[model samples]
Target chain A: GAGVSQSPRYKVAKRGQDVALRCDPISGHVSLFWYQQALGQGPEFLTYFQNEAQLDKSGLPSDRFFAERPEGSVSTLKIQRTQQEDSAVYLCASSFDRSSYEQYFGPGTRLTVT
Target chain B: AQSVTQLDSHVSVSEGTPVLLRCNYSSSYSPSLFWYVQHPNKGLQLLLKYTSAATLVKGINGFEAEFKKSETSFHLTKPSAHMSDAAEYFCVVRGPYSGGYNKLIFGAGTRLAVHP
Candidate 1:
């Protein structure tokens, strides 16, 4: 079976530009999450989705950040007017269900804001 | 709030020597702890998890961790270090359950280096 996968792998954006990262969770996974990893730092929670509903977005740093999982399978994290501080590796993870403690992660998309 | 602290920023060991990565956690209630490893340019991989089951948890690649409530620690250990084990390791704790799901809080991480 396939694991979680993310697209772009790497992205370079100018300040104030918008960028979108995609995540494809494993087949049958019902819960998804997004995290951000800064250089030399551990990953921090960003948002979470249960099926098609965005359950928690409290970890999202600012209003410019948005996420959607309309179909309950694939998800996308979008940043509006990206800033230099937003430069980091965007990670996506998924679990089999809401109660499952284990999360499988994607390779992540490294965004560089210049 | 739940959090984890990795006591050491880095650890270097010779191949075939013991490996120890220390982790301490803070939580309001009984916690679920985990150790994850990350290779360069790769995704985080779960090495082991302690979910209030057995106190000593075993994981893949000959790695294991013991959950000690009294010490507030869940340290990872392996009898012998391998060169392939060189990577960044993170100590994680499951956050308070919210709306039927839980997020993860990670420690700063410990970089392990193995020399032959």
Candidate 2:
């Protein structure tokens, strides 16, 4: 019984560079979510996916942020032109379905933009 | 817009002492409230949830929370604090339903320190 998993536990990037973060949701989990946690702040919702569709992206900070889940099991969050403000921990979560309230989280990827 | 407030930014207690982390929330409708804990460099773990079914909710590791609609609060408590309980705690509320799903709104978080 594996939980949600994310790649690139830590990443350092130069300003204006592009970065992609990956998330592997638990098996059979049809609902996935992404969140961003800034230093000393609570995590904020970034986007959500149900199956292969991107249902919500209202919390995405800017046009540079894009996410995709082509096969529904794995998702990726891509940020173009990395900026200092983009430095934060990116978390991924998954649940059995859209109605499930409990969400299992991944360890998260910490992105540092210099 | 729904929101949550963790009253204390930090709480320090001696081991075996009672622990209390206060939270307040505002929402347009009856909300789903939750408590999550995050250890250093670890993923967030659910402590408990109150979905309007019962006012008092019990969760893992001897944690519990009481939801009081009159006070607009969902405060987490433990009879006795443990050294392992030293970590960050978050109060959360489910956002407005949309497109068959809802997102989670998190409070700024309360860091607990347990000293023996």
Write out the backbone clash pairs for model 2: none
Query: How many clashing pairs per prediction, in order?
Result: 0, 0
lDDT of each: 0.97, 0.96
Candidate 1 structure quality by residue, lDDT tens digits, A27-104? 999999999999888999999999999999999999999999999999999999999999999999999999998999
Where does candidate 2 stray beyond 4 Å? none
* RMSD values, in order shown: 0.6, 0.6
Model 1 chain B worst lDDT window (10 residues):
B97-106
A-chain TM-score, model 2: 0.99
Q: Write one digit per residue (lDDT tens) for candidate 2, span B51-93.
A: 9898999999999999999999999999999999999999999
* Candidate topping DockQ: 1
DockQ of each: 0.86, 0.85
Candidate 1 docking: what grade?
A: high
